[model samples]
Target: MSKPRRWLVAIAGAVVAAGLAVPPSAVAQADEPIQDPLPDPVPSSLGLTVAEFAQFPKTELTPPPPDPPPDLRLIRHARINHLGEVPDGSGRLYVPDLNGRVYLVENGTQHIYVDFKAQFPDFFSGRGLGSGSGFVTFHPDFKRNGKFYTVHTENGAGLTKPTTWPSHSANPFLHSIITEWTATDPSADTFSGTRRQVMRIAEARQVHAIQQIDFNPYARKGSRDYGVLYVASGDGGQGATTTEPQQLGNPYGKILRINPTGTNGTGGQFGIPSDNPFVGTPGALGEIYAIGMRDPHRFSWDRATGRMYLGHIGEHRIEAVYDVRAGDNYGWSEREGEFLYKRNDPQCSVYPLPPDDAQYGYDYPVAAFDHNPPPGHPLCSDSGHAISGGFVYRGSIAELRGKYVFTDLVDGRIFYTEASEMRRGRPAAQIHQFQVYANGQRTDFRQLVGDARVDLRFGQDARGELYLVAKANGKVYKVTGIKRFASCAVGHTRVTGSGGADSWSPVTPDKWQFRGDSVILAEAGEARPGPRRPFEYAVLDKGPAFTNARVDTKVRLDTPVEVTNRDVIVVFGYASDTEFYYAHVSTDNTIYPHNGIFAVNNADRLRIDDQWNEVMSRGAPPAITDTAWHDVSVTHCADTGEISVRVDGELLMTAVDHTFGAGRTGFGSFDNIGRARDFRATGTAA
Candidate 1:
């Protein structure tokens, strides 16, 4: 027989064993008639007397209030498509966009100080210089040297020669390039001066080319003195791939720290810093501080902690933020987020490095989100294809103080984190406390819109104010604070039976049914995730009533599960109803069930006696005994359509049934009469 049918049989047997009447055997076994006498009925309630019910509380304790909301403002908006900030508090902004024109927004009045394409007319060639993929940064002593640098994609030099190759061989186009320039006057805004060629790498693909560049903020100016320039290169322009050897050594998929002067030390463009992590590492490039990055769109440093935060685009499932330390290797091409992606078990060779490998530093993201919106909460999802890292809020906004603010380019939702709550460890710890701010209320940070993209790169001024770069409209928005709203209270009450003070309603009474009573199911408990032992919920089910109608009690779980899928069931129904609902063969619950079942459903709504049809079931034999108290409701949803049943919130038999949805709705037929059925079908027996 199928599991569902077997479950029905078992439940029938239990009812008979509990001294309940059973119809004549519908199906006979081939062997001898093995029927046993009925057992004592188990009451739904564990036998609490009248005095005990009087002392029980009726309502749940309220949750603590959340932190107040802050006042929000929109300071200034810029028309730049993409933007980056200078590390030194110099109130200047660098913007580049689809126009292929790179402009410098300098000083206080949002002035376009330098135009790169205008200064280098021949180099630009009118093709608009492709996309302004990189930001401009000055040498440490810009006041004295007047030297600054930028990385961008320029029209490729055409080649006429043709060569033969296998048909399956790959042939890619080149569109990305990096270059450095110096201003003629140290104090002037124009870039009318000498153009020095630092180093240019070939872009075999157009997608992930020339992301962003920055000069080490800590680097100083002097011959052999200034720190190395840090260039964040995407892994080719394409998505995740390991076929290119250039990604490892050719400065393509890395954060390359190079000295503008050449390696020979004299007359070179840039000098490499002496403290470069890979200066002497075997078979590794000397300029590499860390390696193994894919589509590293943006990165930032916390001035207070010197911690580097990287926003990496994942191939699937997750968009992660990493806390990078020197020599750390962020797993890419082999792993995404904290899960392993690639492996060769025979010899156990992995591309980015194995999870257990200690030589390479595997940094963990400080915060992460799924690409798609989670079930129940749809507002947190962003439409952007990639995740962008923003600056740590060192700004003057009192509400944003000491928080890390970021946004998803696709959905344009703003999220922030409390600095103190972030985990601090070796590579970097994921931020579990990140929250989304909508209007003035804090809502679940999930997919808000199915289709909205915002290209959010960070923008900061000398004063530390933060700004966002919007890609769709090519604009920048300065983040201001928003005010918080008063907290609202939520409560629930259940009524059973009638005609005393008009306060009580009628409910189906089972074997040990009581006349009039109510119960409190939940009180104080830990809100945090992880194994919470001895968590308690209160039960109250005794009082005077005014009317007569069957009332049902229900409990719902709001928190998502992480570790063990177990919950403590606290119930206070009439003793008989509780016993029937807690029948060994009739309970089932699970997590992530196949049918998209959730806790919130129509049945969860409290009902008056007349409305009890929404959950009542007729025709099935009653499972409750008149004078017994029992505990029920231990259930779980399996990864599949199966439901594991337990009594009194404890494990029972796991029965597989395709008819039931993942969600449990109604709660009327207190006894086993409607046990193991899907939504209770209604009809009173004649």
Candidate 2:
């Protein structure tokens, strides 16, 4: 057989070249060790700072309507699946609930735009998590065409009808149907028009069916892709038992591209684009654009590069995001992520790839994360299984620009990677997890939604701003603003009290004494009247006020090690003795205020670091445990509001806060004694 030209060097590319052909079955032998069991849970690097803002409240509809069958009931408070804006330039957005209602949102107010259950009595959204009113999208010319589309599932309603796509399962259970809706008034708030069936596919089960359908938002009116709709179809959880995904005749496990207005497809429902990848191939469906997928759940295109990205839910160990290209086959049953999926040997679901494995020509993901659940949890539990695809941020937020932000569907942990690094042939890009915020304080989706399983999804607007849609409380949060820090590579100078070019002044001169080059905290000062904060410290009175400050010094704890809370604090963003942020590197981390990064703003210090766990009694280890001097550095970026504290050249703790900016640096303690020397500071002089 001829080698597939679309194949490129990828995972295990160093093992062998693409020209060395070998039998596909030779890729995984029974005796091979399970070299790649699971991926590391923690990402090694850090990326852009991300924050989510609460945008809209819960929708009007509470699904199941207080009385429904057990199979129809939902565990979440609402089933808000996806959100998107209408292409008519109305600045209006639409959100679809799995309970069959699509609400039109204007600013913060929402009204029922259409109800699938009320319009089509046979519309089914029960018995499976994915079986519901799935998705909706508008034509690019929606301002003049008055046309749009939707995909939904039914409980075997179309079994008698001829399925447009072929399936190997004889006991097909659910039917995924697509329809075209024409609005009477293109500019109306509510949909009022005629409807027509586009196509239907019979599936073995309810899950892993059609979940997303959208038109290329970047396609111009005269472009060939202008009216084309891309349908993401899954294998209905049957890819492992059958080899149908490798066959060209099946639409399942494929992304089908078709012209909704043309009439050349099966059943005369839609037109298969002539330029489709498999149009003229023998026994292949003309509508297939790309094949070999288990669950092509969600996909989006980057506006800057016009490259498509799809999040494919894996079978057992991997969850991945693919850099999709036409005519490229993504290996599903045969491989997961970059490893071989052993079918006959269920004991080892994945194994290392053989030497000549690339000859089969399977495309791999550009970025992926593996399953890591609690001990004894089910292999593919919902704890962390699915990947919710997201777009490359061309949004108004400057910090998030050019980053492809996505999340885990179950855990709701947000992640992003540089769009430039998501190349197909080379190694996968490094993915970074970002913290979530609500109202102005640092928070997480679990805390905001009050559910361990966040059931998270994403939405993007015409202006490129993004939103976080949580099914837990039916609330939508917008990306109001982002904070990024500037580098401390400029205006660096040494600081000393010898009254030279750069010097310092003690806040409480009586409580501090200079011994050669070391500044000693001789005694603790009286408690402040307003808030409980650092009582004694010396300020950078000679240097210019700095933003994005970096301070490096050597500190020795003068207090005995037996003092549980003995600490040497580094302070920056200091507008006054009362307003400043500090990294309290203490001897004990069990206490809430000890060994944490904090911000004091005319009030008591608030713990801002992510490492502080009040219930778990855990935090960064003591930076200064004895009388020995320890090398410490504190870097704060005012642009991103990121503060990082390092001990002995290793990052110990970090926090994000914009409460104060462009302030002087200082060193002392919260209520203990310490001494500092070799003090140096660098930052943007404000």
* Per-residue C-alpha lDDT of model 1 across residues 39-58, encoded as one tens digit per residue: 11111111101000001011
For model 2, the stretches where C-alpha displacement exceeds 4 angstroms are 1-73, 156-158, 344-349, 485-632, 635-643, 646-686
The lDDT for every candidate, in the order shown, is 0.39, 0.75
> Which pairs of residues have clashing backbones in candidate 2?
483-640, 484-639, 484-640, 485-640
TM-score of 1: 0.54
| Model 2 global lDDT (CA atoms, 0 to 1) | 0.75
TM-score (all chains, Cα) for each model: 0.54, 0.72
Question: Measured by C-alpha RMSD in angstroms, how accurate is candidate 1?
Answer: 21.1
* lDDT for position 603 in model 1: 27
